[model samples]
Target chain A: MRETLRYVASRLATTFLIVLGAMILLFALSALVPGDPATALLGPAATPEYVQRFIQEMGLDQPWYRRLFSFMGNVFVGNLGTDVLSGQPVTRIIANVLPYTFILTFSSIGLAVAFGVPLGCYAATHRGSLLDHLLAFVSVAFIAIPSFVIAIFLLLIFAIWLDWLPVMGAGEAGNWFDQAQRLILPTIALSVGWIGFIARLVRSSMLETMGENFIRLSRAYGLSNRLITYKYALKNACIPTLAVLGMGVGRLLGGAVLVEIVFSRPGLGRLMFDAISTRNFPVLQGTVLVVVLIFVLTNLLVDLSYAAIDPRIRRQGSR
Target chain B: MNPDLPMITIRNLKLDARTEHGPAHILRGIDLEFGRGRIVGVVGESGSGKSTLVSCLLRLLPSNIERLEGEILFDGIDLLKLSPSDMNDWRGRKIAMVFQDPMTALNPLFTINTHLRDVLKRRFPQISAREARERSLAMLTKVGISDASVRLDAYPHQLSGGMRQRIVIAMALLVEPDLLLADEPTTALDATVEAQIVDLFDQLRQDFSGSIVFISHHLGLVAELCDDLCVMYGGTIVETGPVAEVLARPRHPYTRALLDCEIEDDHGGRLATIPGEVPSATWAMDACIFASRCAHVADICRRGPTVLETVAIGHKAACKRSREVLP
Candidate 1:
């Protein structure tokens, strides 16, 4: 227990340092971009004197190091700076979009697991069969195309061509059912790639497990085929697949950005995009910081879960 | 004929399997019989089809295998004729197998109790949970596991290699199978543990009325533990005899070579290795499989697949020159 605690403490400390470094980089990189925030916020029609006045008033002309220290201090105390474009708190903007991105990421991951794990197991069990070959072909095809292409295709098929789902917005209207329906297309787009990767991972892992000595022993014991595949083989196969699934969470975040853009959902990806185009430096910094934090935290969760799933980890931890 | 049938009778069992090269003839027309309460040790070098023969008995050969001809008669029933699902019921109930590597034999995810419970439940569905626990503990104790009740909650990983093997033995015997197939069960354990497991098998024989087919590459272990010994070479049983008689006089050249290679001491002297590899089963061999490596090879020894002719009471050898070869 103590060893696991020590391990987790060390990991969390490293993640904190990384988040700190990332935030600094986000601030520095945003600052280095060749654009005056005041001029961008004021638009091309603003008089030169007024632009200069606005820059001074907003403290855009402050020394980079000084401004950085202040921003860091505020962020340390849970204060992301206010947006120059809307004059609203950056945290509030993130708060509105963060939930949608979370929903998109998690739901897609759920969808990926729902389809990927079973398909992979099926391919493994029915190796050399037509179904196995078809699954293999589908995984390779899905993996080859980028998430955005899948997003566009799904949008075209379900929204434009089929008229089965709404083409725009995360339906924050009507009932909970409507909201869930709105998410379906975006979730499918984000998950298709993940499902392919996870299924392939599961298939290969399961094949290896099926060949293991314990599986043969299980068979020798007269275990039902169902018990052997679902209980014995799948249990072992899923350990490695769990790590892959966790990694897919972070990968899904990247894909979710493209998916959100295609679906026109109010998510972190869309927020980041709008912030970048308008040069909304504060909102951009806040969004990037939140994304990094989520990535680090999820990885920590993944690491901790290893100890729970495999007792060998716990035994090693105790040692 | 005796009123009670033999526990197992394998007749002209031939097995071939697909390999990278071609179909490998693994088991070639094997004939074997053993009665209840007897321990038959199958001793052979690698690729001699000792393990393959056991797999054929269980009908658990790899998917690539093609059974050319065989009838595994267990208690007068033809196991070869049973459907796959029917075979499943008879597998753990009438017959069970213990593997060489106990670490991989038992599921790492399950507790010892769970492993025993699973077998017991299938065998005795009417038994309640409390009674099942008692039966599991009793089986563990029968296998000489100390603190059997406490050990029940432990996972396979928690136990040492020897303990795990014991658990596997316990699980196999929980259903009281009529025939137990132990494929080199002690090969993976230390010398002391191997000895202990062999002793456990002896004890198990008295307590449980079942036949055991123990396969191993260890000739000395087989000589000491088995009531009956069958020596195999190149996918054929080269000799079968009472254990004492075979050790006293091995008729087959391959069995003699295996007996010579048995380690007897920690001396720093050279250890013996059988000359040449066992013939690959993937190709057709028209000559004697052991002729290339046999020390006493002669012109007449090249005939394909020597027949097992009786050389003495209850002893048989495939060597045509057995009378001359015998010391």
Candidate 2:
């Protein structure tokens, strides 16, 4: 238990450094882009004295290095700084939209796992059967086509033509059931490419597990087909499949940007897109930092999962 | 005669498998009657269909196997005719198999109790998990696992090779199967452990009252462990008899050559190898399976399959030239 905690703590420290680096990058890009924040904030028709005073108040008058340090210092002190447009704290904007991003990422991942594992196991067991060939063909086909194309196609069929689900806005009239209905099309669209990618991993892992001597022994022990496949084969296959799942969390979170734009949901992806379009520096910077932080934390969790999947990882440092 | 029957009656069994290349004949007509309470050691070279034959008895062949004909009669009941669910019940209770490589022959993720209870729970459905654990621990001690009680929670990966095999042996015996198929059980153990496993068979036979089907490429071990011996070649039984009679005077050329190839007790002299490779199943054969390796092969040996003929009261050999080939 002591060792597990130490491992997690050190990993958390490493993740903090990574988030810090991403924030620095976002701030650097925000500053370097064409048009000064001072000119953009104070209209061109305003007096130079008024414009200069507003710039001084905004700390744009300070040297670039001093301004960057001050921003970082304020972030460290838990002050996200005020939004240039709204005069509200940037953290408030993130707090409101965070739940939607979580829902999108979690639901899409749940869908991917529910389909990928069984399909892969079936393909491995059947090998050259029709079901195996069809799964391989379709998964590879979807993987190669790109997520954006899949999103557009899903929208066309399910949202526009058939009208099975809502095309946009998390649905204005949404209780739990309505929200779930709204999520169906976009979550599937976001998950199609991921499911395809995960299926291949699941297939190979299942094949390897089935070949293990114990699975044969299980059959020899008078175990029914169901017992051997699920209890023996699936448990052995979980370690490798879980590794892929951990990394997929980050990729799915990143990929949600495209899906959010397509569906126009009020998730972080949409908020980030809107901030970019309106040139709202505080909102844009805040969203980037939040995404970066979540990405780093998720990756740390992924790294920690290696130990659970394999007892050897825990033994690695002990001896 | 009461016609009450021997324990297992394998009559004209034939199994064929299809691979990516083509259809491969695994078992050609195998006719044998193994009576109750007799240990039969099946001796052969690699790819001689020993494993394939044993796997067929359990109906554990790979899914790609194309055709299986003939009936396996376990106590006068045709095993192949039973539905799959019935077959599941027949397997652990009537027949159980312990494979080679004790190191990996048990599930690594499961505790020994998990594997034992899984089999026990099927027949003894009313037994509680706690009682199942106790029964397994007691059985583990029966197979000479020293801390059998403590090892119940340990996985296969945590145990030594010898311990794992012991656990597997215990599992097979726990169900009190009438026939136990052991396919090279000692091949993966150390020499000391091998000796122990070999010796364990003799001690086990007296107490358990079960017939053991031991499969190996070792002729010497076959002579030591088995009361009856069956020699396999080209996916067919070549020779079979009481071990002393068969080993003392090997009639079939293939059987003699296999005994001559035993190297462990050969002292410092160079070991012998059987001449020529075993023929591939895909190749068309119109002769004795071992004709290529026989030194005294006559012209008629190349004609066709040799029929089995009784040489002694419970002995048989499949060679047209058995008289000429015998030493």
Candidate 3:
């Protein structure tokens, strides 16, 4: 328990460093986007006096270091600055957008795990049979197709042709069915590849684990293949899956940007994309920082999960 | 002894395994039998097709390696003809197999208890989870594992090599199998542990009344542990006899060479040895398989199919010149 606390403490420190680094990078990158935010906000024809006054009022008159310091200060105090256009705090915009992305990410992951694990088990157990080959082929096909291509294909079939679901929406319809319908295409598009990726990973790992002494030992005890697959192979099979899934999380988020665009959902991806074109410095920078924070936290979660799943990890961590 | 009663019969067990070239002769015309409760040892150097022979018995050979024509009868049931689902049932219940490398055999992610319970659950459908747990603990105890109940929660990585082997032994003995097929079970273990395991197997057989087909490259272990012994070469048995007789007076030239290579504890004035590498089964051979290595080369050996004859009671050797080869 004490070891867990200490590990968490060290991770917290690392997370703090990550937050700082993310903020700095976002600030620099946002500043270097080629066009000035002030210019974009003013738009083409403005008198010198009005431009200078607008710039000063917006705190563009301040030194780079000074602006950065205040930005960092506001961030530390849990106050990300407001969006210049909406007159809404960056935190509020993010809080509203985040849930859409979060739900999609979580739902897609749930789908992948539910489908991938059993398929993996089946393929590994069958190995060289027709079922194994067919499953492998399907998984490979899903993984090979681009996510947008999948999104468009799913959109074409599920939305355009069938008319079973909406093509695009920001969950604006308020009805749960409408919101869920909007999610289906994007979620499946994002998740289909992950299903393949995770299943392939789980299968190979399961194959390896199945060869392991304990598995053989289990069989020698007259254990049924099903019990051994679930209780032995599945648990042993999780480490590689966890690794692939942890890496997949970032891809899922990045993939969501394109999916969110096609579906027109208001997510951090869409928010940041709009912010980029408008040169809305605060929103763009805030989104980048949150993404980094999410990434670092995800990594920490991976570590914690690793410890939870394997006793060898807990023992190593404590030592 | 009924002398004629072969408890487990293997008739014309011909296995032609696939290779890069194509079907390699794995087992050719193997007709052997094991008496009830007898310890049969299969000894050969690496690549002698000893491992392949046991794997065939279990139907555990890798998918590509096909058993062409064979009948493996365990009591009255034709094992080779059983379905995969039925094979799973037969395995560990009727015929249990233990392998080399205790490290690789047990699944790493699970606790010993989970592994034990899972196996028991398969064989005993009516066994309650609690009963499985109880049975697992009892089995562990039978294998001489102390604090059996406490050890269940422990993972494979947590246990010593000796302990792991014991656990595997405990697992194999759970249903009290009619036959136990152990393939190089102690080869990966340290010498001391190997001795302990061999001794444990002896004790286990006494209690369990299960016959064992022990396969290994270590002829010493086989000589010490087995009652009946077979020496395989080029995917076929070159010689077989009562262990003491075979060790004392080998008939097949291949067997002689194998025994000749045994490391002596004290070199008299010179170390004794043999000169040859085991020939690959994939390489087509039209002569006596041991002709390439045998010191006594004859023109008759170059002819196909080295025939086996009962040179002595309960002793057989597959060689054209078996009469001259033996002392």
Candidate 4:
């Protein structure tokens, strides 16, 4: 128990440092972009006097180091800066769109695991079958194609041709049924490649696990093939897959950016897209920081779960 | 349940594995029997197919098996004729196995409690979880494990190699199998632990009325623990007899050479080793398999296969010059 606590404490410390580093890096990169925030917020036609006052009020006139220090101070207290274009607090804007992005990312990953693990296990168990070969080919095709291309294809088919779902937007604000309807296309578009990737990963892992001595021993003991595969082999096989799934969250979030744009859904991706075009530095910074935080926390959870799944890891350093 | 009948009878068992370079003949025409309540030891060097014979008995041969022709008669039933599901039913319930490396044999993720419970449940599908746990605890204690209750909750990794092996023995015994195949069960343990395990088997012999086929490369262990001994060379049994008689007066050149290879504690010179490499399995079985390594190799040994000829009652050797080569 003490060992686990120590491990978690060390991991949390590292996560904090990583998030801090991302914050500094995001600030530096945003500052380097060749655009004046003051002029971008006010129209280019605004007078020089008005622009000067806007810059002063926003502390844009301060040196980069001082501005970064103030930004860090505000972020520590949950105060993401105000949006230069809309004058809304960056935190509130981010809060509104975060749920949509979370749903998209989580559901996509859930779908990937739900379908991929079983399919991969079936492929491995029935290794040389025609179905295995077909799944292999289809998975490779899905993995090779970009998510945006898949998103556009899905939009073209589901929205333009089939007319089974909505064409765009996050649906009506109050109706969850409409919101879920809008989610299907974007979720599938973002998840298809990951499903393929996870299936391939789990296939190889399960194949290797099946070859382990314990698995053979299980067979020698007369355990059914189904029981042995799922109970004995799959548990060990999933350890590696779990690690990849944790890292996959970040990649899925990135794909959601394109999927959100193609679907015209109001999410972090859409918000960040609009922010970039309008040179809204605060909103972009806030979105990236939130994404980084979620990534780090997801990895932390994966690490903790490793201990739960494999007792060897759980007992490490205790004896 | 006949007292006079042998537990298992293997007749002309031949197995070949498909390889990139055609078939590798693993077990060539093995004929043997395990008497009820007797412990039979099979000793051989690497690639001698001692381990493969165990897999064949379990009907758990790998997918690459190209040819498996034989009759494995368990009691009066022909195991070879049974369906796969029937074989599964026989396994654990009738025949169980102890593996070479206890470290890898038991699933690392499972607790000892789980491993034992699973085996019991599979053998008796209607068994309750509580009943399984009670049986597991009793079996662990019977195998000489201390604090059996606490050890039940411990995972395989939490125990020593010897302890893990004890648990494996417990699992095999939990089903009260009629025949147990132990393939080099002590090769992975240290000497002290090996002695303990051998002693455990010795103790088990008194109560475990079933038959045991113990496979190992340790001649000393075989001599000490086995009632019957079979010396294998290149996938064929070269010699078989009462362990004392075989060790005392080995009738085959290969058996003589194997007995000679055993190092004495008081020896001062370099250790003795069999001169030639083990014969490749791909070679056609047209002659004596051990001819290359047999110091008394004659022209006739290379001409045709030699079948086991009786030297004494219950004693046989697969060498043409068994009488001439008697030491």
Candidate 5:
């Protein structure tokens, strides 16, 4: 128990450092944006006097370190400052956009795990069979194509050609079915890479675990094939897959940006893209912070889940 | 003695294992029988097909491997003819196995109780979880695990190597199998622990009516413990008899060579060893498989396959000149 607590505490510290590092990188990158910050925010219609007044009012007149410090402080207090372009609080804009991205990321991962694990199990059990070869080919194909290309192809086939699903938006505001229908294409595009990678991972790991002594013992005891495969082999196989999934979260978030842009979904990806073009520094920084935070937290959850999945790990942790 | 009434009989069992290269001859028409409540020791060096023989008995060979011919008669049922599902029912329940490496034999993820419960549940599906737990506790205690109740919740990694082997033995015996195939169960254990485990096996034999086929390379253990002994060389039994008789007067050159290899603590002499690699089963052998290493090799011994023939009362040796071969 103490070991688990210590592990959690250390992980939480690592998470903090990662998020801080990400914020510093985001701030440095934003500062390197070409053109005067005040001019970019105020636009061509603003005179010199108006630009200076806007710069002073928005704390752009302060030193870079001071601005960074205050931005960090504001972030801790849940106040992400205002978007200079629309004069809206960055937090409000993020709050409005997060649900869409959340739905996309979670659903994509859900689909990935749902399909990847079974496909991997099937491929492993049916090694050298026709079905195994087919799954291997399909996984390779999915992995070979980039997410954006998959998104475009899915849009082309399902939306443009068949008119089966919407090409843009997060569907009607209150209608769950409409939202689910709209999410289908983007979700597939986002999840395809994970499915391929995870399936391959699970297949190799399952094969390795099946060769383990415990598996042989289980077979010797005449355990049912289903019990042996799912209970014994799959559990050992899932450890590596879980670790991959944990690391995959950050990649998934990055992948979500392209998927969201392609689908024209009103999510953080779309919001950040607009913020980048408009030089809305606060919105860009805040969106990046949220992504970083999610990535770190997901990793921590993965580490904790390891203890739950394998009691040996739990015992080690307690020790 | 009613020699016709054997608990298990293996007749003309031939296994042709499909290797990456092609089919390799594994077992060359093996015939063995064990009486009820007997401890039979199958002793052989590596690559002699001792493990393969037991795997065939359990029908646990990999899919690629094919059994060319065999009749494994147990309680009037042919194990070779049973469907995979029926075989599953027989495994663990009727015929259990204890493996070599105690460290890796039990699943690391599962607790002792869970491992026991899984085996118990298979046999007694209608038993409640609490009753299963009770049985598991009782079995753990029976296997000589102290603090049995607490040990039930412990993972395999939490226990010492000897403890883990005990747990594995307990699990295999939990269902009270009619036949136990222990494939070098003490090979991975230290000498002290090996002695302890062997003692436990001896004790368990008295309480359980099941027969045990103890496969090992250790001649001392086999000679000390086994009632019946089969000495294998290159996938065929070179000698078989009552353990005491075989240990006293081995009739095959290979068996004599093996017995000579076991050094006594008091003997301050150079250790004996048979020279020559075990012939690959993939290669066609028209003569004695051990002819290359045999000091007694003669022209006829190298010209044709030798068959097991009675050289004494209830003792057999598979050598053409068994009468000439001396211990």
Candidate 6:
């Protein structure tokens, strides 16, 4: 138990450093955008005096380092400033849409794992068969196609052509059935490529694990093929898959940006898109920071899970 | 299950492995028998099909096997004729195996407890978890593992190589298999550990009445532990006899060469090595497989296939010149 505690503590320290670095980098990159926030918000028709007053009011008139320090200071105190266009605190805007993004990301990943792991395992065990080849071909095709392209195609076929689902937007809040119905197309669009990616990963890893001496021993012991493949082989094979899945979370989040825009859904991706166009640096910085934190935390969880799955790693951590 | 009958009999067994060049004949017309309660040692260098023979016993041949024709009659029933599911039932319950590298034998992701308990549960489906644990703990203690209860909870990675090997032996023995196939069980261990494991096998002989087929490259180990010995060369048994008789008077040139290769502390000269490489497994032999490397190679050896000829009571050699070659 103490070893676990030390392991988690060390991982948390690393996560903190990663999030801080991402925050600093996000601030610097946003500052480098070639547009003045005041000008973008006020428009060309606005008088120079109004623009000057707006700049001073929002503290854009301060030097870059001071702005960065104040931004960091405000973030540390749980304040993300106001959106210039909406006139709402950036934190409130983020909090409102965070649930939608979380639903999309988690549900899509859950779907990917549900289908990918089994398909990959089947393909590996039946290697060189026609079905295995077909799965291989289909997975490669899906992986080669970008998620946005898939989203557009799915949107066209399901919403526009078939008229089977909503054309846009996350469904009405508090209505579980309608919300799930709307989530179908976007989730499918987002998860298809990931399913292919994960399947390919699991296929290769399972193949390698099956070739291990212990797996052969399991077979020699007369364990059923299903038990050996799913339980014995998959447990060891899933280690690499877990690490990849952690990184997949970040990729899926980035993919959600385009999917949300294409679907016109209310999410951090859509918020960031609007903020980028309006030069709303505070909202953009806040959203990016949250995404970075989620990515780092998921990866930390993945690392800790390695200890849970493999005793060799657990012993190493204790040492 | 007549107690007077031999435990297992293998007849005219042949196996071919698919290689890039074509099919490689891995095992060529093997004939052997194991009397009840006897320990047989099969010794050969790498590529001599010693390991393949054991895999054949379990029907665990690799995917590249092109053909396998044989009768593996375990107590009058042919193992090769059984369906896969039936074979599975026969595998752990009737015949268990111990592999060469214990370091790689047990799954690293599982605790020794899980490894032991799972095997018992699989063999005896109605066995309670508590009973399985107790049986496993008893087997561990029987295998000379101290603090067996505590060791059960430890993962395989936490144990030393010798300890893991003992656990593997414990697992095999716990099933009370009628036949135990051990493929170089101590080849991966240090000299001291190897001796200890050998002694453990000696101790197991007292309780384990089942037949054992021990495969190894170490001639000394086989001479010390086995009641019968089979000398293999070029994927075929070159000689077989009572261990004492074979070691005392090897009837085949290859067997003589092998015994010479064993290192002795009093030897002052260079280490003895058999001349020539093992014949390529891909070759289709119509003559003596060892003709190219045998010191006593003659025109007759290259002219026709060699078959085992009786040298004495319970002794045989594949070489036609067995009587002249005997030292």
DockQ metric, candidate 6: 0.78
What tens digits encode model 4's per-residue C-alpha lDDT throughout A1-319? Answer: 6877776777788889999999899888868877786787788899999999988998988999999999899999999999877889999999998888888889999999999999999999999999789889999999999988998999889889888889598889889999999989888887888888888988999999998888887887898899898999999998999999998888665447777878888788778778878777788889888888889999989988887778888677244
Per-residue accuracy of model 2 over A1-319 as CA lDDT, tens digit each: 5666676677778888887888688778867888977677555787888888877887887888898899898888766666777788889888877877888888888899888888887888788899888888899997888676788899999888998877786865448787788888878887777777777778888889888888887777777777877777887788777777777776666557777878877778777777777777778888877777777777777678865554445445344
lDDT of 5 by residue, A1-319 (tens): 6766776676678888988888788778878978887887778999999988888898888899998998788888999888877789889998998888888888888999999999899889889889788878988998898899999999999999999887698898999999999999998998888898888999999999998988888887777789989998998999999999888876666456777878888887777788788777788888878878888899889988887778766556544
Quality of model 2 by C-alpha lDDT: 0.81
C-alpha displacement of B57 in model 4, angstroms?
0.3
TM-score of chain B of each: 0.95, 0.94, 0.93, 0.96, 0.95, 0.97
Local distance difference test values of all predictions, in order? 0.84, 0.81, 0.80, 0.88, 0.86, 0.89
| lDDT, candidate 5, B251-315, per-residue tens | 98888888888874356777788887888888777999888888888999889888899888879
Please give the distance, in angstroms, between residue B203's alpha carbon in candidate 2 and its true position after superposition: 2.9
Q: How many residue pairs clash in each candidate?
A: 0, 0, 11, 0, 0, 0
Model 4 misplaced regions, further than 4 Å: A31-48, A63-65, A317-319, B265-269
| Model 6: colliding residue pairs | none
- Per-residue alpha-carbon lDDT of model 1 for A1-319, expressed as tens digits? 5766876777678889988999889888978877776777789999999999987776778999888898889999888988877889898988887778888899989999999999998999899999889888988998898888988988888889899987688886556888898898888877887889888999999999999998888788787788889888888887898887777777666447777777778888788888888777778889888888888888878777776666667667555
The root-mean-square deviation over C-alpha atoms between each candidate and the true structure, in angstroms, is 3.0, 3.9, 3.2, 2.0, 2.6, 2.0
TM-score to native of every candidate shown: 0.91, 0.86, 0.89, 0.96, 0.93, 0.96
- Each candidate's fnat, in order? 0.61, 0.63, 0.71, 0.69, 0.71, 0.71
How accurate locally is residue A258 in candidate 5, as Cα lDDT from 0 to 100? 77
Over 4 Å off, model 6: A31-52, A60-66, B265-269
Give DockQ per model, in order: 0.60, 0.52, 0.58, 0.78, 0.71, 0.78
| Per-residue lDDT over B201-315 for candidate 2, one digit per residue giving the tens place of the 0 to 100 score | 8778888787899998888888988999999998889999899999888788888878777754456776777778888876556788778888878889888967778887888
Chain A TM-score from candidate 5: 0.91
In candidate 6, what are the lDDT values of residues B1-327, reduced to their tens digit? 887777788999999999999989999989998788899999999989999999999998888989999899999999999998888888888889999999999999998888887788888999999999999999999999999998999988789999999999999998899899999999999999999999999999998989999999999999999999998888899999999999998999988888888864356866688888887988888889888888999888899889988889989999987767664
* Order of models, best lDDT first: 6, 4, 5, 1, 2, 3
lDDT of 1 at B234: 82
Model 3 lDDT tens row, A1-319: 6866766677778878887888888777756767766777767897778878878877888889998898889898878887888899999999988888788888899889999998899988988889788878998999898888898888899888888887687665467877887787788898999889888988999999887666655655556677779876798788889877777776566457888888778787888889878877788878877777787788788878877778777767656
User: With candidate 2 superimposed using the best TM-score fit, by how many Å does residue B79's alpha carbon deviate from the native?
Assistant: 2.5
Q: Write the per-residue lDDT of candidate 3 for residues B54-81, one digit (tens) a residue.
A: 8777777666765468788877678889
